[model samples]
Target chain A: MTGPPDDETRDRIDDELPDGEPPEDAPDGATGDPVPVADGGFADESAEPHEPRIAFYGGKWASTVPIVFFIFWAIVQSGVLGIGDTNGLVIGALVGTILGMFLVRGDWKAYADTIFEGMTQRVAATAIVAWLWAGMFAETLQVGGFVGGLIFAADALNVGATTFPAAAFVLCGLLATGIGTGYGATVAFVTLFFPAGVLLGANPVLLFAAILSGAVFGDNLAPVSDTTIVSAVTQDADIGGVVASRFKYAILAAVPAFAAYLIMGSVLSGASLEGAAALRESATAPGLVHLISMGVVIATAVAGRHIVEAVSWGLIVAVAFNLAFGLSSVADILVFTTTSPTPAAALPFVRVGETAGVGGSLYSGAIGFFPLIVLTLLIVAMAQIMIRGGGFEAILEFLLDSVATTVRRAELTMVLGTAAINGMITINTAAEIAIAPYIARLGEKFNINGYRRANILDANTSALGYIFPWAGGVLVGYQVMVGPDGLGEQYGPEMVVNPIEVVPYVFHGWFLVIVFLLAAITGFGREYIPDRISEEVSRA
Target chain B: MSRFEKFLAGWSLRSSTPDYEPGDVIEVMVTGAEGDRAIARIGDSTLRIEGAPGDAADTRIRVAVETWDETAHRGTGTYRETVGESAF
Candidate 1:
């Protein structure tokens, strides 16, 4: 007869167990003490080691005030004021953090430490690291003339005005999915495809919407996507499983979206093709070689390689392709030259040179995400404070007890809850991290599959993030449209598609949300992994 | 399961019936207590396990199916072994 194991015995047992799979006899769940699974460890954000009491606020409500304030401020700043600046969001978040300090009931030191801990949490850092790698890889692809290659392909295909939008939709979706960043795809398509589409006499609004719809599709399915990563990591699901399980839903929505784009493209074709020849003349065949680079990333990721390894391979291939094909100069791919004796120039990499600033697409691409990375860290910190303060618990309790009683209702809550949070939050990835724990908890209550939970979470997040005018994805795309480097020079300010104008035309995003809602109600695409735990899926 | 059956299965909630059969392998977590019989949750339905190793409460383990009753929405299984901690 084996007695209850001692601490030493337990330690030995723990060491013998597989990396992510805990021993079969370990105490877990509602009855026994919850054992943390390494792969998709259920780090109950609201149940951290910190003392729950706040210094001055009344219970959990006061502790939750900061999160509520931030949400309200976000809505007012981005949604109402239409100032979709990351700097402004940073300010709002900073102010909210300060206010949270005031509400804490404990020693100021402890509160400060909590804030620091939240800022540097592994979950937040993991996403940021992935973003940096993704940004660099995406920028590398862009520098390798991936967009030019796409244009070349479109031109070679000789797609008519009636078919261009639908074709563009497919191409952009493929590009975004390969690159794992919808925002990058949006900017690329809006800059390259938009002008070409207009030259071919396609309706600009429909074209713009089609581009955004493609972005939505990619964000929903891309294995390297930030939202996909957050949804998977937060729900303790594997990226591979999340990507696979979501295929059905993505395809279901995409078929309709593709048809809609084709139908709209035919009906809305009005351009006279006055400058189509010139646009076609500028497109080079060599640019299309980057498609192979995109293919490498997709194949590597599907083969279960680490995301970093996969993207790194893609980046290397893209850079090599650029150099070998003479698509872009080495200097243009990565320039360190800077003009004027500024503080930045003092740095070893940025000595005085003829160029006023960095000229390389790779340099700009990686640095472009710096503001968002900082924003993500701050938001996660704020989330940590809210979790430690018991805000998440209160919300989860209400969601599970009052709202999500049945499995179907639970799934619906997961979908709608994620959508609502994403609609309010400008940064979709941030919204995903904030609401992921709730989705995991709610889904787990009914033993919902990790892939299913991640699918539902990411699908709604991707849709809402792009469809809303104030959303970060839409705003970023709009900025590109208005920038001097984009449509402003080619077609003037009049040709720039207003973010709001494109919202109604984002048929795919709206359709995706509806499809998921229906899926939840009718139990479509819902699967359970029988005896398998979420960690297993997460590990895979 | 055939592709058609799998497609139809995705449309209905798993908890609506005791769908497991004999010799099937499943992962389950001990969710609650039911006298001497340990109650484990698989998907949305509960199963009573006889002669569970130790206290089954809260532990996740693989189980081999033995019997099930559709009307009662309950099933029985023999504990194969423990797998890991519950994800929830």
Candidate 2:
């Protein structure tokens, strides 16, 4: 398949060849290959390359345009714009789009086409499939009582209250990785883990912090995650390469973050689960069948399966387990698929309804990723138009000439550029999708290993999103903290840890930033080699 | 070595091409254990050694390799290398 033209090819086409000595294999002559049109002759028909006129749009000033709208919406939705909570992002985006129409001086036709192109590319398709499967698997498992089972198991372990935060963090991290969405992870933890932590008398702030940190860890590291998919695809790297490359950095920040939560929990709570013994005695250990469903999802993801296939298989396995074990009837599973009071109903697990047989819970996990799917396609279409219109040419040319001259600076630029984009968007997955094309093109220019580029992009996007107060991860975690008997009630607004409150507490995010910086200066973990592809024998 | 093996052995494993020259002072935004900070310096590749997980940092820190291996972790924080001058 034809991919982006490489540097050597593009340069040769620019006609900067010295004298009459065009290099061998150059596209300069003869009957073997199509020749370029001479300076004075022939219609310039190199496939009518749809090279749109060069012009700048107000929308091209992404940082300025997107950021203002995001901030305005954030303030509004966050109650800074008004006293009531209402979705503000849609209004913000609408304003941005309208502003683009007025401020951008480019061809209106090109802009209109760009909308279609941006929203229906391969990048968007991949994201849609990945999210859908992830949603289905996570929802199915939730229905099966996977999360409740996790709590029961944790309770059974008789952990000290001080350490419960750490344990809970680990579990949530696993859940996010398995499910593939930091936002979903946040939601799961708030509904399932948060209430449980409060009942056990754990330090509410620490508990909330633990959940946020865990979600970030999984979002940064998971192979199926939107950020991971975007970072890899944009960099022209494979998913495995990205996941593997970033593993070191994620773990580097994660381990300490986990320990810090544990330490904080210990210091703040100064005790074990208040009713651990009694809860363990009374809490029926949900059937191990539920655990099997969760295991199927995590194991398949780690096994290097494509996320959709892995999650699909996981759903089937979960359903089978539910019915086979008599844990849930078919009808019960179906009812659980839409909306369940219990978070596990969101997972693949089936539970007995008030009266029904087995069925899958929100079993259409793939459908849940529809928003991201649409967002990705739209972003890609927009990116293509930008590319077609030379929106990227000026910036790319400058970056290629300047940063490309220095290896360390280039690496640093990539990390920071990705981080800045995500910081503005406040959504890791969507940010990854929008900025992927540039990131990939930049890496190829410098011969940066796809894996390294992908890793840096994903790590930075993950880190920056959580550190920003307007981020979904932060917002959802904040919501969980304000509920009755939550962090807000325990510590008041002073200790309640809003998005702003938790930004400073995001130690993992800070650690990641430091690691990348040191790597650039010292060139310690840099990988200069590309993975080799095997040659296949020509078919007869 | 076989042709493929030899080629693989000689290949540069570093992610980016070695484009920076010695003594070229450059500014970089460093992020990791210490958080986001910028540093500038004239690079001296000879003295900039790659760091191990438990290794003590004398002046420079190691960057992560492109390959994702569990051993690449240097504590619970990322380590980076840069010339020690502040950019901002």
Model 2 is docked with a DockQ of 0.04
Report how far residue A520 has shifted in candidate 2, in Å.
1.7
Instruction: Give one digit per residue, the lDDT tens place, for model 1 in A172-218.
Output: 89977876777766765765677667766678878888898998999
Best by DockQ: 1
Error of 2 at A408 (Å): 3.5
Q: Lowest summed-lDDT stretch of 10 residues in model 1 chain A?
A: A1-10
Q: Write the per-residue lDDT of candidate 2 for residues A367-461, one digit (tens) a residue.
A: 33343344334334444544444434334444544654456776777776777656755545656665565555444333344566667778888
Off by over 4 Å in 2: A1-59, A62-67, A79-86, A121-140, A172-195, A202-212, A215-246, A267-282, A319-332, A336-406, A425-451, A465-502, A527-540, B1-88
For every candidate, the chain B TM-score is 0.70, 0.20
Assess the local accuracy of residue A239 in candidate 2 as a C-alpha lDDT between 0 and 100: 69
Q: Cα deviation in Å at residue A414, candidate 1?
A: 3.0
What's the TM for chain B in candidate 2?
Answer: 0.20
